[model samples]
Target: MPDMPTVSLNKAAPPPLPPTYQDPQLLPEPRRCDTGAGIVWIRKAFDMFKQNIGIWLGITVAMFAIMMVLTIVPLFGILSGLVVILFIGSFMQAAAIQERGERLKFEYLFSAFSTHLKPLLILTLLYMVSIAVFFILTFWGMHLLSVSNFLEARVALDSVGVSSSKQWIVMLYMLIAVLPMILLSMAFWFAPALIVLHDMAAMTAVKKSLQACLKNWLAFLIFGVVGGLLSIVLMVFTLGFGFLLVMPMMLLVYYTSYRDIWTDQPLSIDA
Candidate 1:
């Protein structure tokens, strides 16, 4: 018989290693960026979106679908905040992967659930509590204002002509009520990314995020104005369909901003 060729069994090659930066590191204090950096962050995010448009769209749609489902189901809507936190962390992870030249996959959307779920959930709970406190205080303050207004109006009716509707009181109340929630949002703006990327504790991450926002308030103001205008334009031109693109881009912007402010090594636009 002809000599049989000897077959050698070789083990499958090990899977490629993830990007080294994925490992948690001790991040420095957030940097204060120039106002122009806001526009740069948005442009970089758009570049990231263009690099993997299809995947970005898919992730956005998936997230929207999940949120809708949660909203429609009774009592389950409460979970929407938790879902948002998870997705935020996942988006940060995806951004990191893309920054390293890796192709972003849809599977990355759920990666946070495995690695950072607990802390993310804690963040969500804290947000919910803050919202609840806001609503309670708003109602209580409104009631007190109404009573005071009523008493003052009666006094005015007896004295000079009837006072105007006291609309200023309502305006003042609204301003006061909104301020705390704005601060709450600032505290949360970068907390998820800090927890996901730097492995910071929940409270510590919230503190850092707030400090970062205050440190770079000018940049954030610019970012908010530009992003708000873009959102309005998209909604007007696309009749709301543009949210399919805007949603993902918003997450990418967040990731880019976090990287720019929190890390010594920020992602380049070209990257």
Candidate 2:
């Protein structure tokens, strides 16, 4: 067989080989507060707080009202109302962020109710399932102890030839109940991030939220514990001016974590 000449991009010979294409970088540095990314975000959040206070306050009020109703009303189907809120959140939140300069608005959130219903519904189901799991584990653990208490214990031990202390049984159940508090916090730690950043379906956002925490389990658990302790301390000291600091800090932590994992892209400087 004759040896074949190499093809090249040079016009005089064969065309030169095409250049290799490069993909955009993944796993870029997250915008950390130490890098002043958090500072810029703090500024933006300040603007967000200042301009969207009324919107947020109103939404908060509406939500609180719904919660109150759920607690007070029997079979009023308040779970359904919660789905309404999550759906409304999709549009209301985006509009509130975008219209931070507008200062005051009434019907902006109403529009979200109709427009973002699909993703909102998915998120609602996800949230419901997570909450259900949290409660189920909590109650089941409690019941497990109740069944093993006193009379039940005497009956079971007579059959099994073993014994247990009331204190130990109670303590074990307490630990189980408390475990959900931490799991619930971490499980939904990225809920808002998934809802806002990825525009993921509710089930997926919830699952991803759980996975994100598992991947960064220690940090996420520490965040909840420290954040909770600090919030209580601040509440004691500042009569809730603390929320001005607390809310922003909490949001920043989640936002930074989400950016690091999902986007993993550099932020462009403001033009």
Candidate 3:
């Protein structure tokens, strides 16, 4: 029997490991939050806002001024809508930064502009089309109504010593326009966060946002009512200066709601 020689092999350390690729599609589904969570989210946001009110206020004011300037540009005034959507995503990013215990910077105000500008701009265009279609339908409905009641409308106007459908048209448009706009606003509420934070496409974000709203419509309804009242009171008490505080806090609250839903975890007060 011959003894076999055992050879010891030196194994070189494996080349420095490269970063692992993560699955981008592994996003968590949004959780169902209770109606009370709306107020909790608001409180969380206000606490976050208190940490750097001055910076938040400055960012809010700057955003306002930029949007105002954009609004005044002639022949290209429509560009402001796109700018507004981009800024909304930027502001959400800003809130996310603050939520993560990072120092908020002025640059966060433009973060989305660099990262998700095109999709956000397209989101704005979709929003515009939504509104425009609603407006046209409203105008058409009013036209039909006016035609159906032409004689009665004329008699009523003559009784009031007024002539012309212009006033009625304007009134009808105002009344009819608000409902669709509010519905659209709710549906689009979470789209920016979904697009910027989750890296979703415009239409995907819009659809998911709308579905999230529909699923949580009751909570949103309560939040809207209570939050609207709180906003009015805050605005009144601070003589409009509160807007500087309220505006950013509201945005943070919005981001909080989106985070809570999408991540399936509510942020703690201490967080």
Candidate 4:
């Protein structure tokens, strides 16, 4: 049996990393904590972000502009536009993780297209399926409740009479709505993390994502709720400029929190 490797957080992270990375280098070989400054090397990787937010932001905007163009710019076919966008986004994410000088450009977004397209698409579809399944299950449950409480409720509305039947159905619908939120949220909990950190088929990533969430439901929920609320506030208050800050913070938080699995050691970073 291979030795169970020990993970030491905040240790040696690979060099030439981008500045926006506030995480300690997480090596797959021997998993490590996301914080890079304890029992390990203590260096912040976000120098690029702080020093060049303008240029980086411009690049991101350009990429978004290209996406807008594709909607109108007729291509050989829909496939052409989709393929281009997918490559663009994936490459951008992956490239952001590459060495400093080459990090966070519109060009980076297209990096993963040629080599990592199929797996990335598969993972994305798996997340979509999880979403679809959540809705389907909730809808079915609601339909059943509605049937029992509303129209055709008690076939003979005259004889199978019950007081406040509509109210009862409404309660049931609420319960149904809440049920999937609790149950299915776990399935897609770490989907984005899995997609970015590992390469696998969509179905497999979905399975793993669910497993990861179930394994650490409490922690994930806490993380999700806090992040979600912050996002909502940002959207409302700043009219969305808040996304620039919120996005990076949540991304790092998700990445850090997700390291919970596949390693024993823990390192904490403040949100």
**Best model number under lDDT:** 1
Where model 3 places Cα greater than 4 Å from the true spot, the runs are 1-28, 149-178, 268-271
TM-score of each: 0.82, 0.56, 0.76, 0.57
Tens digits of per-residue lDDT for model 4, 157-208: 4465655465655665687688677666556444544555455455665576
Error of 1 at 217 (Å): 1.1
Find the 10 residues in a row with the least total lDDT in model 2.
24-33
lDDT of 3 at 104: 91
Candidate 1: Cα lDDT at 113: 96
lDDT tens digits, residues 73-135, model 2? 778666655655453454334433443334445454445456556666666666677678889
- Candidate 1 residue-wise lDDT, 1-271, digit = tens: 8999988689788899885555334457777787778888888899889999999899888987999999999999878767998998998988888877788999998999999999999999988888899899888877876776656645655576654455644556678788888889899999989888878899999999999999999988898899999989998999999888788888898888887788877654344
lDDT of 4: 0.52
lDDT of 1: 0.84
Clash counts for the predictions, in order = 0, 8, 0, 17
Please give the TM-score that candidate 3 achieves against the real structure. 0.76
| Model 1 stretches with alpha carbons more than 4 Å out | 1-27, 149-167, 267-271
Model 4, residue 224: distance off in Å is: 2.9
Name model 2 segments beyond 4 Å from true.
1-112, 145-169, 240-256, 265-271
